[model samples]
Target: MSEAYDLFVIGGGINGAGIARDAAGRGMKVLLVEKDDLASHTSSASTKLVHGGLRYLEQFEFRLVGESLREREVLLANAPHIIWPLRFVLPHVKGMRPKWMLQLGLAIYDRLGGKKTLPGSHRLDLRKAPHQAILQDSLKSGFEYADCWVEDSRLVVLTAMDAEARGATVLTRTECTALERHADSWTATLEGDGGKRTIEAACVVNAAGPWVDTVARTALGSGTPAHLRLVKGSHIIVPRAYPGDHAYIFQQPDKRIVFAIPYERDFTLIGTTDMLYEGDLDRVEISAEERAYLREAVTRYFRSGVTEEDIVSTYAGVRPLYEDKAASNSTVTRDYVFEVEAEGGAPILSVYGGKITTYRKLAEHALEKLAGHIDVPGEGWTADAPLPGGDMKDGDFAHFLWEASERHPWIPPEMLLRLARAYGTRLDIVVGEASSLEGLGEYLGGDLYEAELTYLATHEYARSAEDVLWRRSKLALHLPQDAILAVGAWFDARREAATP
Candidate 1:
């Protein structure tokens, strides 16, 4: 391994992974270390939407909204297969803000971004349209708007994959134990599956998400007043509750809004409560009360009610929102803040807060901020460059899917389309020279096949069956417990066979 690098990123979430990719692409030797598997933390536990935050307008956070709206378009363009358009139907309520105000917000949302391909926002009468069939009678009028949906965790992995492809060293399951400032550089102690090792870098970036302040204060011995607020957001997943393609935004009595979105191929995702989190990151779990709150919130809006029994899975994530000292967690600023600690000869750059929607721009701006401390001579190239498997023509996902279908005639249409969506042009590597379903090998669970599993294990840095089943693919959701156990056994046998 090299003794020193141009950059060292301390997390594997969206921000760190993105910065690593951008820097590596710019000819900077970079190293990214994540304590756990990539995106195992809050990056995977998001609402998984690229939105302009229509609600932010009410908080007068026009700057954040405008930036997010612009970012939404960029992200949608770069990863058209995984990041696609979503329409949200906001039903007007009796006691909430005026319709004209929502319309104004929609107008601002449309124009704030330099939109080229995705359709802009428009008004809709819920009672007069087919969407009415999905809603109750009280929702008479509403407006339909555009946003993008993303597979949040996969996006992080893809970013890391792209960084590695561009010659960045990615080390997961590596804990940053300590940092020592040497002359003109920083040496970091990292211990992972391969055991303890020391790596040196010109600059150290602390993008540890929830552990940002810990790295700054505890690890690096810098006490400059914590710049982050860890607010806990929880989400629940259930089998598809409603039969509509469009998502719903319901206004609650407390001025908070709840979203009921379509998820996966056969499930509905409802969530997210903004509550202040004052506990350990490892201990952040959805309380029974919080589950009731989410279920009740959804139950109030739609005719259907989701009880505890309906939730197939629950996840909680702590957003390291830039500390705003706001009373309501919902009112906390979603903007990011950076602190550069340059003392003597070394610099430690720390990233505080960011959203999945703005991660790309966040990375570009982050590098721009850290450029002054470290003498670097490269321009940012992330905005224009496509991510791995994402160099589609005109970013036309539909055309690409049709082409993939034509090439792989034996694969089911839905299966082919899904592969094209997830892997983009890289689907060729996953499907290989298969001419029939039998060529794909055994169906372990979900839509997973032995061919895809082998590809993931060999190419995508998948270490275990959980890495393949849970994170790489949501086969755990579709597979029975016994099946998962069998897959785990198979992975163990395969790994052992390869071991020296």
Candidate 2:
């Protein structure tokens, strides 16, 4: 194919995928390339809460918090399956902020963005309420509030799928090595399974997340490297340690807080140690000290208690925070920043910092910056567009699931739940006319079957077993190690057989 496109996007994270979805809907031809799989970087590694960043209230970021909170309701309406209501219990410590002040923050949160659906926050008496069941004995009071939980990595994949359906080319495992701006357009070089190819475009978007500065300096040769502050955030997964479905957020003496969230079916996600990082993004790792920090924080608040032995898995991500070094890691900004460089040719837009919760709005705002250079139809369209499988009645998945069960009466409950969450109204595509568990194809492991794998392979562009187990679904958390290896082997052989 000859070099041609209106826009060329580098990176496959949520920002890149969201931008591709937005621009394509406006009738622009887009090609998004990523060196690895989608959501392979910071996009997948998150605390997994779609809150308004209540802690940000102390940082005087009301505008950002409010805008994000508004999008929260919109996202819930858009993707109800993977994103749903979650309650959080913030155990009140004597030395922490006064009860009235904490209530003020929640009250503002509960009222911000014309609140609806979500329940308001309430003060708790640890001596009498069930919220105190998981609290350490020293704590006597607490508060309960609402936020939404998300399948972070799947959100990126769904956005890319939506973009592809809207006429954008989403390329995973494709690397953009260099670019040169001509008189009116830019030529970019990419290397991948499609072999070396050249693409021409009116503009380039560097939504490389952690690789933003590198793309600016190396590919587009912008000369001046944009400022970037990399902060390493790590999470640990442990067996469920408490009863009930609500999550817990505990305050530390340093004013930093930690979360213990119900994850998968029988696990709790405890994490996120934020420490200034100077390491290479490709080699981000959870330090032993960081693990100790997370475990210590969990132990301090949860009456069930957790130690290093309790941890089953750990993941670390490098936050591509915009360079504004603060006195502490907690003070660094989570809001996103964009820089556009036209340079007498095609404009190149670079995204610096952002979080999972604010991705959709960030995508809308980034496209707004490319007005004259990169052609867009008008305003925005993604706020109403359904993301991949998110199209359902009233954007409600529960109702869809109930109706699907009647259609496939013999299908197991496990298969039905997976289908509903991953494909929403399109569950039929995976289940088809299967009369029972056997008809769904071979069972790879817990909640994973050959039918779902084949559908992901043919439609969602899943190239490896990890794409299914880790990103597309969290089945890896339930499957045995041997079963995971078996599935990996199966996919590898299939890929080799289909090699061109």
Candidate 3:
């Protein structure tokens, strides 16, 4: 007989993690299972902004924009280390959106959201040095607005960490093969490396992301009236296009907007083409057309002219948007919708079409939808609580970095900063009283050390070298091919040593 949990969340993306964390904090016995690594899909492949969706306002998605804008502040307050304010430079192209229209839109955006800590929008002189030197000569004006940059994947991991700390069971690389509904509960069969197990739960949350429909049809064995529009969005990483910390949001002649963001300290991240995705879900890749489209989008504004050869790496993800019957893929609503179906008293809530910016609110609403069916001991509490290492004193990242340096004087400044930014107050756990770099164990490569790898494996659910090198940290971009190979060998050796 398996122990019955109050809630079983199916998925490991931001929404599932957030829901698990929230439910656990509310005193509900929760279990969350992910089919793959956390945020291995859409959540990690975002433009990585915590903005109000300025473009969404053009489509009259005022409610979504307002909620997202408010959530930006909430997320920033809760996880200051991974979420911080970022300024955007929107260069005004001739015969595109008029300058007054841009200013009016920004003003409405500023007013729609409640009180904010980040600065409001204003005009920009693109003819100046940093802007003029990089942008095309014809672009002499622009608008600067406030948004935020996020460590998107880390946010998902931290949420899961918080859920675990709050006594929630989080299983990664585990698949929910089938779910049997009863008059009072659900018996779920979960398969993982350790093998299969049946877990009983009072309810289920199908936050399966791209596989939401499949989970509903196969696992739950229910066919409700709902459809998903899979849209593939691709991004390209190139050598830093300009010498500034700020990012650019350029308007194209086709009325679509593309962003050029500063990434990985030495690369400029440009993205995202929205095309109807009808291909295999597991094998999403950047198409040549998308690559060329993005290059042209950036080249139109930059004097240096972006080209295909400049691309260092590319990534593509399929967004599981709710079927809104919109005219085109890009116009599909980013707002989330929940379909809660209960048969024989066992409820399954399916999440559809959500953005990274509004995940917290989505979780809150999810719990609200489960109110009468499940017993929640407490009200919403995640908004005020910091996620895992995010509890820097007063949420001041700069002060936290300084304090980290003061405590671990032996650690290198660059390494210490990276650790501080990534782990915040949790740096000491990884350092583990190590007084020197040598004390941290063998240097893996680049900034990676053996001690850090151990910490990731044991704490952050990193199973493969790719998990640590790419998703956990962008070391894949920094480390040489040989170094990456060495890291993989180290993982294999570690697993062998652990084998009994």
Candidate 4:
């Protein structure tokens, strides 16, 4: 008989990774499997905000809003490098929701969340310099509120890294092919580049995001698994539409809201159409209609019009919202629902419809549900714990950056800042004893160097250039085509040389 694990988790997105980290911290034996790179899908494709869904207040989802808002503070503490404060400017327009209504909504929004270190909502003068320069002349006033920007994909990777460090086994590019449940435990077959293997676990977490229902049915027989409503949300990246760090929230004629956010220091990110999705899940892309919709949506509020020629990149992902049969796709609950099957055998907890902001709470709640079925050795302690690189002195990232500059005088300021954001306190491991850029390694592309690539491969489970360029970081957007190809070639040559 093989050694049994206390928990077996499927998927490597935020929820799965969060669960793995939580379970491992509890001293439970855990094995987490991902079919592809971490955050390769919906988790990475988010609007990248650690925020309470302000619009949810209109849907009477006060509980969800409060929970998400509380988690934002928790996440900011856990991963300060990848998550930081972002202010949003919502301009008040005529023939729309009245200013009183907006004020009421913002007031409720400000209070629903717990004690906030972030600044509260206040009125904005759109006719002022930066706001006036960006907005249409007709727009006179607006409201400014606080949310946060996050490197969404990096959050997943860091969670997985923390899980592994805490004594859990994290297997990326590994698929849970088969699951056999017994009265006391579950036997799962996993396949990957490592071939095939089987493992036993007392409990199972089906956190496969979009494939949640499919995993449930596959594991528990075809007996009417939980229904999932996959809504497709797409975003377009254009040259920076505004000069300020603040983002914009535009209310559409159809009552839907679209956000135009500053992205990558050089681009504006406009997104998210909430259309009912019924297409290929793996190959989701911004459709011509969605692009036109987003372009028109932003152009309506901006003094400068956006055209197709300005689009630099585009991406789309399917959100696995728990089906509620709402009047419209946008009305569907962003809240998560769990279905635990433990009546006749080992428990299998299937997670459905969770957002990035509330993943930590969701994981804590999942463990609470499993408490009756298994021996939980650890308590819920993730709320205040810092992720791998987040434990800077006094949790102040700015101070940490200044200290890093003093320590590594030979490194370029831009490169140091980028590394500081990506690795946080762990930048020490990447820099090592190198006193200069030449000692660090050959420059691959952008700020990517051989030393950084080695660190990613050895520590972060990065296998290919795509994992480094896209998921691990957004270097793909900054690096030229030839530079990207060189990175790919470098990885290929190294792998070929190591092959027998």
Candidate 5:
């Protein structure tokens, strides 16, 4: 007999994971399946910010900005380890939007989200020490506001882990090949390492992100109306551009903004060009034009210009934005829209156009929509709930780190910080009973050890080196090439040993 579930969620991105976690918490038997790894596509490819779209105010997306701003507070409180405050310096230029407009926008942004832990926006003197040395001479002043930096893929994994902990089944590297809708349930064909099988679910949530239309067509047939405007956003990473913990928000002539954030402790992450994407969804990469565009975009502001020679790595992902008929790709609404189709048979809620900051709220809204067609039992509860390893005293990550340092003084400060930030209160699980560095199992490279990999595979559903290096953690950026190869070999050995 096929396994039965109250909810079946497709897509392992933030929205799908959040939906599964929310639904499972609401007393529903849930199963979430992802064709690839969690956050392997668009979710992992974000600019990695949790903020109210400060620029969206110009497009009058007040509701989205407000909701995102509010979510910043909720998410920060819930997951302080991965989601914390980041200050942004928005430099003002003579030809750009006037200072008064910027000031007014910041004012509205500050008030729209209501009372919050993060500080409100304020003016800055760019002629000061850090800005004078970092920015061009013509830039006399700017505005400073607060957002947050998130480990994008880690957030997805931790959310899925929480869902699993709450009794939901999370299957990674597993694809939902087909969906057969019945009046009271859905029979989905799933294919993965274990081969093919079918499972029945009372409802389905299509949070497939870039593949939303594909999944919808598979479930509702190919004639279904296409409502996705695929916009590709790309980012470039280079050796640290400037010296500071604060990030810069650069305004472009096209009225869009680009961010230059300090990444992985030793690199500057800049990016995100919005272009209409029409290529294969599975193989998205940054283009030559985008590389030059990003270089020029940052060069116009920084004292040190970014050139092609300085680029080290690049990534791109497509945002499956709801087709709002907006002329400019940059102006499409970041707010989520839902398409609930239940008239034919069982309910299938298709999600469209949402930002990472607002994913939790999107899930609540998704389940609320599903409730109209299915038996959604529990009330909204994710807002106050802490995700896996997120429970800290007063959600104070700093104090928690200090305490961890005391507990594991033998560990190096840098490695301790990385582990604590990645695992939070669950760092002990990664370390296991290792009382010293030697006990951490084989040293893979850098600060990585076999113990951490074991925890990831055992608890976090990590299957391959890419899953560990790129998504679950950014160790790939810091590890040597040989170490990277060794990680792959380790996974290969593990799989071989398990095989009959």
Candidate 6:
């Protein structure tokens, strides 16, 4: 007989992973399946901020901004290792929104989420030390506020990890090919390396992100109307643009804002252009126009103008925003909307449009919606639960790093810092009992080692070199071409050895 589950979740992105985690903790027999790796699409392709969407305040999305702001605090406390506070410098332009309006918005933003640990918004003197050398001479003053920088893909992985640890089965690179809803249950056909299989689920949560509408159609017939306005957002990476740990937010003449954030220690991450996306969802890439737009966006604010040659790499992803018939793609609401269909059969709740910062709350609310149709036990509990390796003494990353350094004195400072930041209290698990550099097994260029790769395969569901270099750690940015090839070879050999 096919295995029966209480709930079946489609998509391994943040939303699906979060729901699975919450449901499992509530004693539901849960399973989460993803067509690709976790966060391979929209979730991984964000501007990587856990902010309240300061720009959305202009559109009067006060509720969304406030909820997101509050969730930012919750996420930071739960996953301190992967999420941290980042200060942003928003310079006031000559013809842009007035300084008074900016100040008022900042003041509202500071209070909207209630009292928090992060420092409140404050005024900045652009004529001062760091800003004078980095920004243009024409920029006199601006505002500085607190947001957060998140390891986008890592956050998804850790959430899924937590879910798995709580007894939720997570199957990556597996696609849900068919969904047959009966009067009281769903028979889902999943295909992957293990081949096809059917499982019975009492309820379904469609958290397929960009494929939400498609999944809905698969379950509710082809005529189910689409609800998503695919908005393509792109970003460009370049060598360090400035010296400070702070990021810059530049205002465009079109009323949109662009960010240039310090990324991966040695690179500046600048992005995000919003355009109506109508092309392929599987392979999303930055258009030439988007690349130019981002370069020009930053050029107008910084002393050192960005050019085509300055761009080292670029990425783009589609935001499956809920269609509100907004005038512009940039102005569409980011708040999540749920479509529940339980009239004739078991309930299949489809999720639309939400940001990473609000994913936890989205899960709780999703379960609440399900509770009306089915029996759901337990109240919301993920708000205070720490994700894998996120627990530390008072959530102090620096103090944890210091203790790690004392224990692993032989490890290089740069390597230790990276490991500490990525793994938090789980650093020992990656390094094992290695006493010296050679104890980490074969070195894979940069600071990567075979031991870390083994840990990922054994515990983190990593199956390819791209999964390790790009999504898991971004080591591709630092490793040489030959070393990268070697990593691929290692995976190929491992797979071949397991083939028998």
Predicted model with the maximum lDDT? 5
lDDT for 178 (candidate 5)? 90
Comparison by lDDT, 2 against 6, better one: 6
Q: What's the lDDT for residue 250 in model 2?
A: 82
How much is 340 displaced in model 5, in angstroms? 0.7
lDDT of 2 by residue, 280-384 (tens): 788788999999998899888777678888899888998888877677888788899998888767788999888888888998898888886656777788788
Residue pairs with backbone atoms closer than 3 Å in model 6 (clashes):
none
The predicted structure with the larger TM-score, 4 or 6, is: 6
By TM-score, the better pick of 3 and 5 is 5
lDDT of the structure predicted as candidate 5: 0.93
State the lDDT at 345 in candidate 4.
Answer: 89
Estimated TM-score for each candidate:
0.96, 0.97, 0.98, 0.98, 0.99, 0.99
lDDT of 4 by residue, 1-500 (tens): 66589999999999999999999999999999999999999999999999999989889999999999999998998889889999999999999988998999999989987698899999988898888888889899989999999999999999999999999999999999899989999999988987998899999999999888778878888632567899999999998887888899999888889999999888899988998888877888889999999999988999898999999999899999998889889989999999899978899999999999999999999999899888887689899889978998777999999999999998889999999999999999999889989887988877778999889988998889999998899888899998899889888987898888
The sequence of per-residue lDDT tens digits that candidate 3 reaches over residues 152-241 is 999999999999999999899999998888877999999998899999999999998888998889655655467899999999999999
Inter-residue clash pairs, candidate 5:
none
Q: Higher-TM-score candidate among 1 and 6?
A: 6
Show where candidate 5 strays beyond 4 Å: 223-226
Candidate 3: what lDDT?
0.90
Pairs of residues clashing in candidate 1:
none
Tell me the deviation in Å of residue 153 in model 2.
Answer: 1.0
Best-first order by lDDT: 5, 6, 4, 3, 2, 1
Model 6's lDDT to the true fold?
Answer: 0.93
Question: Worst ten-residue run, lDDT, model 2?
Answer: 218-227
